[model samples]
Target: MKPIFPAIRLRDKGNWLAGRDGIVMAFFIHRDHSEVGPAIWRSIQAYLRAIPPGSLNWYTSADGDMVPLDDEGWEHNRHVVIERIGGGSRTVELRESPSEAGSYQVEYYGRRLDSPFHDAPATTLSFTFPTEYLVEHGAVRLRSLALELARELPLNFGYASFALVSTQGSWASADWDITEALLARYAGLDAPRAMRLSSDLGTRALAPAWLTFLGQPLLGQLGGIDALRDALPFPEVSLLPMDGDRVLVTLDEWPDPIDTRTKPIPPQYRALAQRMEPFLFQYEGEALLPYQQDMNRWIRRFL
Candidate 1:
């Protein structure tokens, strides 16, 4: 099928300017209950090499070396540090997986910035495709090539909440949990205290209302006040698949657009809708850079 969006243009030759919310194949370190230490790391590296423009390069290492660690050296080791090639500062730290009977840990060391424009730190973002491209020329390869083409386009600024991430399960599971937790715990709280909930306890008590308005049901909707709250329109957030992809590339959380003509929408409700606009975009199999950049700008404004 023909691509809906034109190939992205890159002003910065060295770095790829990915549109916000676009999915890209990424290297992830996983720990499974199987033989060999750093085996998963090695597998992912090998996988990275097989892809076109498969330079097997590191963003951090000056030498641009690309090699996987073997079991003999890493299996028993407590930690494995994977740094980006080509002198990039990003890195990931992998530790043994933990269990009730055992213990293991992994950390995402995102980009270590010398300085950033905002108070927010540098971040590492990841997405995944299938293993078919490395093995056979197919749709996955097409997507990768399209991404590379997009990379060749101009550079633009974007912001993310974190630099490094270490999760206990699949990439999707970890990413969803972390993003939600960060949004609720950090950005949401840091937002200006509106006049509606000025009192200390009022703020605490009313906080859940905002969350509920956002489509996160704190208390189960059985009946009574909770059920009434549930009936209210709150913005909803969900991860949904794009086309036939195994993973859901898009994460949507928006205020419910349903007008409350019977009951006028509150001022804060209006603020939330205005606040969240930058983050929402319609994707119909097109280059996502513009939409992603827009969303990032909104996130930055709210942050």
Candidate 2:
């Protein structure tokens, strides 16, 4: 069978990379780094174990240069992750070579609880996996991994969905045209802003994705899982109760990169968006560029 989304690589002009299908899973933890750091580490370990050995061959160093994930470099990166998790603000990034498409990637941003810079503080952990892994191992395996990670972390809001992953931020990259075009064509392809959302998301939820994880006060605010189920009555939607008073809402059997150019947004996604509208986070600033305007519009696609 043909893949839903074929792998894409534009190494010369844009240095872009995307797999046949891409999965972007992110969690926002309202707790301070000191409290959630260990959990974050464990989640990272879980991710590493899930992927092939040596899949991650590079990591971003303190100087922002990509360094080989050699023994010494790996140990140093580990120290940085643990040390930053223990005390101050932290940003940990590990990934395969940017030259390769369908590479495994992990990005984490941990903020200090008492930092004056962040009005809405939350630690954000994001993971990117090529859907080839899912196709080979099965969707159930990925779902189980997501559940395990969610169970371990104290997250306020989290989501897993099909996305267009690139080496750089999609909004600010030179290949914004390609990114924008793909996003316009595919309603299910998410443009994740983990770094931006970490500082602003706080306890609020973003738009719903393929798999939406609701925890704590957010779930309570929505009147719990029962209310959600009642609101989203589509047969394609499933609400699974999780540990820590969290719930994982699955939108469909597999993520659909619905071609919006030819079809309407999936009803299940639209319904969940409407149900979560009151609590969804909207982009606040004025969009100065066409790409920015497109992003803001995408944020409100379901509304």
Candidate 3:
């Protein structure tokens, strides 16, 4: 009857906040905002429909602030999101409540291929949900929802897994020590940097998660599904093909936040990482965190 992943809470500015052990479903698209705006909106709508009503009741504003999701705020947010997605703005972010115990959050970073500021940009959309929802609705429902969103968006790469979810701004400054501690103990928990990845991920694959979505050029480079299957011979891993030449690689029946203090990294995950190392994205330049020596080493943890 224990929880699948550890529940984490941390204090920031004298306020206790939920910091880790949540589910994150994210996708990266290589298309420009003008080309993929409508589809992203559709996928967002689908996510809203799948979750409970009022699960999201607040959103971040233009000034990088949180606004109540009132009647007027809702209408205005819709307009802003549409405008940003249509290339009216460079990035789009929406959140429920970062200070709340467990909040639902969504974020999108668009790409302007012609802009000097954007270097190898690939638009990214990330959706976060508390583990309580998964416990209530079951893993099948969560996987079905991920599949549904995948079909709606033309994603080059995507994943769903156990993650350390927090407000990026505060968590980085206040909770990183705690984060490093938790990560040391739990090898399966992913600490995602969606905004940074949006700018740098490009067409490369990331480390494999519980549910890894692979599409296009990268999938072709790997010699398609048959080759991938031959490389990853684990029986627990399931490869489900989807429309649009994409494949959803499910590592196991459920996401495991393996406590490495007591057990080693799961073999299935290591196998997938080994098969994907060549095509995986390498983090260059400065370390993402002050304490971390090399981001690439972190990306290759499964190896």
For 145-257, candidate 2 gives per-residue lDDT tens digits of 88877778988899988776544444344365666677778888887777777777788888788789999889999999999989899988899998889999998877667
Tens-digit lDDT string for candidate 1 (114-177)? 3242122223222222222222454445333433322311111111111112221222222344
Error of 1 at 151 (Å): 25
> Candidate 1's C-alpha lDDT?
0.26
Query: How many backbone overlaps does candidate 2 show?
Result: 0
Identify the runs in model 1 with alpha carbons over 4 angstroms from their true place.
Answer: 1-3, 12-50, 62-303
Q: Give the alpha-carbon lDDT of every model.
A: 0.26, 0.77, 0.77
| Worst lDDT 10-window in candidate 2 | 11-20
Runs off by more than 4 Å, candidate 2: 1-3, 10-21, 84-87, 98-102, 168-171, 285-293
Ranking of all candidate structures by their TM-score, best first: 3, 2, 1
Pairs of colliding residues, candidate 2: none
1 or 2, which is superior by lDDT?
Answer: 2
